[model samples]
Target: MKNQYQVHCDHIDVALPYARNSGDGALIGSMFGVCANGGANGADDVLVVKGVFTLTKNSAEAWTVGEKVYWDNVAKNVTTTATSNTLIGVAILDAANPSSTGVVRLNGSFS
Candidate 1:
């Protein structure tokens, strides 16, 4: 047990984006985690970096299994477009066209 070491912490505190109030979710870099507990204005709140999250999407296009997904910072939704988007992760399940959300298998945390 002495040699045991942990690599990453899934939950951490991150500052909320401008105009994004506490309890709201955000996409920080490649991370698409949520805020919980309590925090406000430049303060660090809980951010979950891994898991299957059901987030809002473009809703105009359908998602296929294993398709690469990206986070649209401006639109604040999951999208298939890579241009000007943050690579969040991959779509684990398929979403029918015109849907509002999709299940994403989030990648593990980084430094």
Candidate 2:
């Protein structure tokens, strides 16, 4: 397979909530990290690693299946969380040839 550039979302509480609130609505605010501070309170530890998904922008808000997205590996395993809300990408099993933009070149961790 070719090299894929996958973004690693920090093990942050803010990120987890975003993943949870994905299908709730459009990216209204906080285009940045919501989990701040080194010794801050964490949500539940549910992590996720998203990928390129479709976005129904300009016209309306929607979570298409081919636009830029994020992902969380640590959270996935640690929390066994659900990213159905704000995530886009196949699991490691179906992500053989990951897209360049939404690929996680992880060795064996989040394969």
Candidate 3:
């Protein structure tokens, strides 16, 4: 049994693709996670791959609980639209139109 599990999968160290702030959502390839700390691009930081978090969302879109949510990497926000976006998780609460945030539960899966 040479192969052994080292750490819990809930969090991981990643080479940031861009400068990020703590609590920000990050998409690396098809994997999505919340930044546990702020860091410059190419810096090593921890990403929480699971758990619920309030994330930035499209200001004009409304969301209901259980609705699928996507990450708009360009805008750096969660969105209801699927096209050209990465599926990160689902809405865990209702988000009003003109709102800037939404509650989501991260799926912690690649795409």
Candidate 4:
């Protein structure tokens, strides 16, 4: 483990946006990561990345496994549509309906 190059990690905890819940897969910019160790708004908590997270989904449309998912900032839910949406990652599990949670893989890149 000497001089090992690390890639993904969950040790970083940064300030959470105002009123942002500690739910897994909560959209943080283009990436959909959440602070598992729930914290108050504007406080720091454990930020977990690179894992399957159950997140809120837009129930208006059904989703299948491997579908491209986007963060609907307006609705505060994950959607399959990309119109005016921020690409978060792909769905690893199917969300049969809206107002439910689906598992997503965190693979969005930072720009």
By lDDT, highest first, what's the ranking? Answer: 3, 1, 4, 2
Of models 1 and 4, which has the larger TM-score?
Answer: 1
lDDT of each residue in 4-108, candidate 4, tens digit only: 555556545567664566674455665556667776667776667666788888877788889988878788777888999888778997778654778888663
C-alpha positional error of residue 62 in candidate 4 after TM-score superposition, expressed in Å: 0.5
Over 1-111, each residue of candidate 1 has an lDDT whose tens digit, in order, gives 687454557777677663454434576666666556545556767777777778788999899999998878798788999998878788999999999889887665331
Which portions of model 4 show Cα errors greater than 4 Å? 1-8, 108-111
The number of the candidate with the highest lDDT is: 3
Query: What clash count does candidate 3 reach?
Result: 0
Q: Stretches of candidate 2 above 4 Å error?
A: 1-12, 15-21, 24-50, 60-111
Instruction: List the lowest-lDDT window of 10 residues for candidate 4.
Output: 4-13
lDDT of 3 by residue, 1-111 (tens): 478554679898899999999999998998899999969999899988889999999999999999999989999999999999999989999999989999999998477
Model with the higher TM-score, candidate 2 or 3: 3
Could you tally the backbone clashes for each prediction?
0, 15, 0, 1
lDDT of 3: 0.91
**lDDT per model, in order?**
0.74, 0.27, 0.91, 0.70
Q: Estimate each model's TM-score.
A: 0.77, 0.19, 0.95, 0.76
